[model samples]
Target: MANKNAPFHPIIYVRGYAMTPGEIDETTADPFCGFNLGSTVYRAVPEKERQPRKFIFESPVIRLASDFGYQDVYEEGYDILDPEWEADPDNKVPSRAIIIFRYYDEASRLLGIGQTPNISQFADKLRLLILRVRELVCKNPANGIGEDDFRCHLVAHSMGGLVCRALLQNPAAEFRAAVKHVDKLFTYATPHNGIEMVGVNIPKWLDMNDMKNFNRDYMAEYLNIKDAFKATGRVDWLPEDSFPSERVFCMVGSNRMDYEAALGMSRTFAGHGSDGLVRIENAALHGWRRSGKNKGSAGDSCAKAFAYRAHSGFLGIVNSEEAFQNLTRFLFGDIRVDLWVDVEQIRLPKPVQDEVLAGRKVSALYQFEILASPRGKLWYLTRRTAEEDSVACLSHEEWMQAPAQRQALYLSSVFLANRARVNPRRRSLAYSMTLGVRVPDYEVDRRLWVNEHYEGGYLFRDSIILEMVPPKAEGDAWQVKYAWQGSGVSKADTAIDAKLLGDSRMEVCVPFGSSGSPGMQGQLRFIVSLWNKEAAGN
Candidate 1:
């Protein structure tokens, strides 16, 4: 009776941190916290420059209900988990639903005593909640769901992510069954490594209001990773064996200027390269790859994206179109594509070339900017730019001295669901990528080269657009087409086939600029394949 093939399991939303008793009561005041809150955003189209378009994004709750037919478990002013809760005997709640993990209720003045629990205790209660949800969905004769058929996904924001991580990575025997029932995890702007203030990690001794939950040493104890303060001295990773890293997704926020807490004191101390509170570098896990042997490698790399939204506010990451679109696709997507850059060589600038020819020691720094968007959509899937301090950096010496092989960088991953596309009639899946390699800042003999310096200049830049139609069935070839924004090629030109890797995988290589010259040059390799093909065969 399981609907595993449908891939629409229950989504448990765990909200982010609330620092005070007042904030605790605020979360308790609302039935679904802020999950039910909708946001209205304005868009200015380039074609109609002056006319701003109003895009009303109904909250995730509303969209899920209207688009996916998911219903909540609340009835007659009481949740299914409430002590006095009662509902129609034959009308059971559907398997597709959203459950709010009210971990803060026990600490709320209106709901319970005003004392917050530690992260471990919160995770423990989550285990119990998962069990209770199964009882509600599986025992009912109306839905035909069995105990074996029930599975749930965890969706958390900020510190809430840490609470879930504590459960998933918990090594204790008691939590194993609950961990098994959780199929996937998605987090938004979570400080996975622990929060840093004034360029230092938050001390465990700062134990006010259980703020020590954000401390790295304390987090290591709960996450059950020993010596997590690795050579990098950061615990921004989970043990590979704890959870299937591929099932996890992280959404990193880059805009800190919009956070207005404490009259902007939060953003000031949290500083740049942060989402007003959690730094971008600490937002994602170390090991989060969907495929490959990560047994002894550095932590796995989860599928993640970057957004310009701040930590929490009207412009926060949780309630935005970009976040929602990503959430829907990842939860029920058909195809998965990962983009990586293999730098064959980086040609130096005219001036830098002259210095290198003179056999002088020249040093430089290269930064890469990546932004991706789905076709016919105003919002992007991921955003990383120098302006947001979220771009990738490479040292000239490392690329030169390191192995000549081309496995240097990864941009991001984007998923596609024909079911979630703009036009149902159109069969092609398309997205555009804006990738740029900045001009290196030359340091001749470790000294700054200010003479020929210009700000915001790039050695190479282009928008790569890809349009593809999935294989009609398994073992069939894929029809892929691509065009470059500045290359004078159009989508109407022709379609290129992806290079088929054995086992139903495909790859498309898009090369840019000239190689081994006095300009930047490299290849963007796209690995494409069926995602959860068992669930959605299309």
Candidate 2:
């Protein structure tokens, strides 16, 4: 039933919170529990009033079915979760299936129990679901699935991500081995650090539908991060001994205005830099790797991406093309590229330069933005800007400090070579990244200077598109081509290649500077490496 071994593991979808009874019922009523719901709109698409809409990406469930031939366990009007549902001898469940972790079913009156279960119980159900899926996949003898080789990928949104985390990080005595069955995790707009509103954490007293489960203190208890939380004041972390955070991909949402929950009041409470319900800063977890500066400190953060999508809606992060693309690639991609920015120098404007040259102190803040996307797509995989309140900002003093003193600037990582390329004839994997630095607000002599300032001005902006052709045979030379957008120049025009660092690694040096004026000068360094190639193909 399966040709591939690593990447095609069965995917189990864990849905988000059902804050109220009606929402719980609505989720319970659905067969796939909203995992089957599709979206017709994306962040770049205009409002519904705009016509000639040509883009309509189906739900993740349908996409998996159509693209990868994954099927559900529903048969005879019964799901695998149903006790009465028995395996059909004539038809065996496909090894590659999209199983929904319907943790909320027990909470609906139409289903089992009428009361909603807390997050702990939800984790319990998740463990059982994995084991249950294992039993089903192993049922068919021809499938050749065994307990030692069977694994599942967990795709979750919001609180559902926490459920899986609960299982992985800490499970009940009965389900302590649940972590062994999970290979990778992908979270959509999950408040890994715990959800906050109005600048305060969700209170423990507010127990509506167990909303208090989001309280940081409470989460630390169930997730078994109490000591970590006390030491770091955060519950967003996965113990390396249990599961490395690098295996978790977090899709963080940036648009709060489109959440529309509570008639847009939720956005107001979440304020800016949020997805209405979850703040952007709280949407991802910290990794386990420690940095060189100190041992036993958090370093090499968990993989995460930012999009303009909201928490959950037509514009939600879950149902959007951006999220779907990320989810699939992280699960099955063969190439992983991590981007880093090294500022060689930050030149000032003519006037600002003159002030600095005269020995007068000048203070300024620089906002850096990066937009990354794959080939043949209009949407971005990871986007960060000042407007999104997620951009990397550096003060002039910070820039003056040595790179060693300052924390390394990590833009985002992109996974590729999973979804079959559009042009099978072309054997190269390609993508583009746009890096821009906004003109800063200069303060000479500690006083704000606005005389020559113009709003919405950039110090430098350009797109670096890369085309990587894999080695035809082992030890053969791998070819790489690159160019800056709108420069009237490409590798096709002038044959060029990236500087090869070593085996399985390539570095593309893209230098940027303002024309005819004193401005920023730096080169973006991209390190592309082979992630998991066993499943890579056209």
Give the candidate number with the greatest lDDT.
Answer: 1
| Lowest lDDT block of 10, candidate 1 | 42-51
Per-residue CA lDDT of model 1 for 8-94, tens digit only, reads 888899998998889999999888888787667532221223543467888889998999888887777778776667445544557
Cα lDDT tens digits for candidate 2, 1-538: 3334567888999999988788888998998877777788665532334443446878888998898878887878888866657645665666788888888888987786888878878888888889888887778775677776677899999999999888887735566566787888999999898888889999988887798888999998988877677878988877776687778899999888778999998999899889889998899888642324453457557788889878988778888888888888888887777787767766677887888889999888788899998888888989998877777677787776673442347788888873557797888788888888885588899998887788888888888887777777766666777788769665422335566678667776666667656476676777777765544541
Every candidate's CA RMSD: 3.2, 3.2
Regions of model 1 farther than 4 Å from truth: 1-5, 42-54, 86-91, 288-296, 357-359, 492-494, 514-518
Question: Which residue pairs show backbone clashes in model 2?
Answer: none
Residue 525, candidate 2: C-alpha displacement in angstroms: 2.0
lDDT for model 1, on a 0 to 1 scale?
0.81
The collision pairs in model 1 are 287-299, 287-300, 287-301, 288-300, 288-301, 288-302, 289-301
Model 1, total clashes: 7
Q: What's each prediction's TM-score? A: 0.93, 0.90
Q: Give the whole-model CA lDDT for all candidates, comma-separated.
A: 0.81, 0.79
